[model samples]
Target: MRSSVKALREQGVWSVEFTEAQYDLLVRSMVTFLAIEKERFARVVTVGPRAEELDAIISGAERVHGGKAVIRTSLDDIHMIHSMLVFLPTLFTSEEDFVTRVGFFKENVAEVAAGLKRAIVRTAVDV
Candidate 1:
């Protein structure tokens, strides 16, 4: 996924398939990636359980900003992650813009990453 993000910066599109379990991790990774690379991924699309939570965060942010975040979601765990990378490059130019775009979502990004990481690890162990 990090590679995809890097490549996306050079090119404009990237899409990768992930299992439903990997999709869960992808959501967390994307959130963390967005937070750290906020300048690069200002606009984003997230999917999975975490994505639903992000939708609420974005909705609240939209209310406060008086403008909508350029984010979209499918609520499907795997598809969201796949589509997100494909959609990411179209949203921002640099990581700074990505961070700025995170806005209020920053508060929840850490918590979500931690939870998703645990879930991903546990799932991996079980499988």
Candidate 2:
């Protein structure tokens, strides 16, 4: 799954240039990847003083997911999410630890997902 995500990222799958149908397919693929990793992310653990900060980040992401805020999706935002999903894990001892310590919070995963949703809505409207 990670390799597939990396391959998509390398291919610039999130670029704004994609046709609506193509973008929709890519988004579905991304959503699937996230779903597959959800259990792993939930198992991540954080220790030390930085843990609180990480918790706050997760809370913020939850709020975003809950529609407490509006996020404008940009290509760069999509790229950031891809980087978090693909590259960030390699920097830590484990994928779970990476997520616990900094993944959702640092990467603003919810906001980015919201932004992607907004982009999709915009595309639907445009169509």
- How do all models score by TM-score? 0.25, 0.27
For candidate 2, lDDT tens digit of each residue in 45-105? Answer: 2122222232232223212332232222344454444343343334456546645554233
Please give the CA lDDT of all the candidate structures.
0.37, 0.36
Residue 123 in model 1: lDDT:
42
Once fitted onto the true fold, the runs of candidate 2 whose alpha carbons sit more than 4 angstroms away are: 1-68, 103-127
Give per-residue CA lDDT, model 1, range 1-127, as digits (tens): 1111111111322212233333344444456445543432333323433543543433322111322122222224324444444444445576565446543233233343344334444544554
Output the TM-score of candidate 1. Answer: 0.25
- The whole-model C-alpha lDDT of candidate 2 against the native structure comes to 0.36
Candidate 1 has an lDDT of 0.37
